[model samples]
Target: MSKSLKAICAVAATTLLLGISAANAGKYNLGRKALPEEIKAWNTDVRPDGQGLPKGQGKVSDGETIYNEQCAACHGDFGEGKDRWPVLVGGKDTLKSDDPVKTIGSYWPYTSTIFDYVRRSMPFGNAQSLSANETYALTAYLLYMNEIIDDEKFVLSDKNFTSVRLPNEKNFTKDVRPDTPTQAQQKPCMKNCKTEVKITGRARVLDVTPDAKKE
Candidate 1:
């Protein structure tokens, strides 16, 4: 056979084998394996150690401008937050109060999370629209507003992302508590759950039932 014919036959065989395998595997032939690009698109998570930060840079000043244009309406001018919206600034020492003001500065543990979250989802209706630099700037701006960063000229980038930390970072420690396993893992008594169910109490005697006479 010709080289092209062999290639075509190989492809056809591979496809047929895959179809047969999938068909015999299970009752539900669902979604295919995720593509590398698809996984990469959703796998834009930046860790606390700044592992997955993209290559970009933004100054706090730039962040402020972007915030005002996109984030201010809901987040307020100074990140005070508008009506029913969450406050992103202040609440530095209100954590112990009866109503703790858990803003980004006071509550979030990692700075990288701020960048990651904003990049993944922000601008309310427009998520994942911010470029890497825009995300960096926004993060830098938030840091400044929260008093985490000292300068508006401070430029934020993936390289220096981990240097900045949230106030709550020191408060967060590794959870040493044991994990609770699901009840589904336990062996259930499917047969003869109980010897018998007896109604030992009378509802009428307990005055739980309505009176027979009309009120």
Candidate 2:
């Protein structure tokens, strides 16, 4: 074959191969675009600013009733927690203690988080079962139990959801990794960098771990 003709044939072959590969890539139509209702159902997450909260109102008194019926089995009647379950109230100054008890009143940074979590995953096995109004009621009841709000008749709705703020909200700052020195820039020592090695303490001597050899 002529040199120019051979070069043209090679180029044509390469183009054909690339076209075949592109056609075969991800050829299987495994999934389709989600339906509007499906998208709405899965996109039920409420944001910290109450952006996705559903339109509904619930009173603290109503929440207490719903909580006692649906939630008291796991969480106590007043959000004190049952057995090894989570305690949702109190724990005011325990954050600095050795055994810090983090609770909804002391640890959570937003009221929306409380509403969102409970609305999505509460009542133990049955999740996403509470109506919008019921979730708001439960949120209000929790706030009242934590002494954040005093009124039993206080209605919680999307209109004023952002009005209630958690005490720890001020403690949480935005992630500033872009503005701060990275681990590589922090001069992390990877090799024998320490001048001297001293045994501060032994776990066996401190009885921190059980002596399995003694058995």
TM-score against truth, every candidate = 0.67, 0.70
- Please report the candidate that would top lDDT against the real structure: 1
Q: Give the CA lDDT, 0 to 100, for residue 36 in model 2.
A: 96
Worst 10 residues of 1 by lDDT: 206-215
**Regions of model 2 farther than 4 Å from truth:** 1-31, 174-215
Error of 2 at 111 (Å): 0.8
What number of clashing residue pairs does each candidate have, in the order they appear?
A: 0, 0
lDDT for 162 (candidate 2): 92
Error of 2 at 20 (Å): 20
Of the candidates shown, which would achieve the greatest TM-score relative to the real structure? 2
User: What is the per-residue lDDT of model 1 for residues 38-106, given as tens digits with 9 covering 90 to 100?
Assistant: 988888999999888889999999999999999999999999999989899998889899979998889
| Residue pairs in clash, model 2 | none
Alpha carbon deviation, residue 176, candidate 1 (Å): 8.5
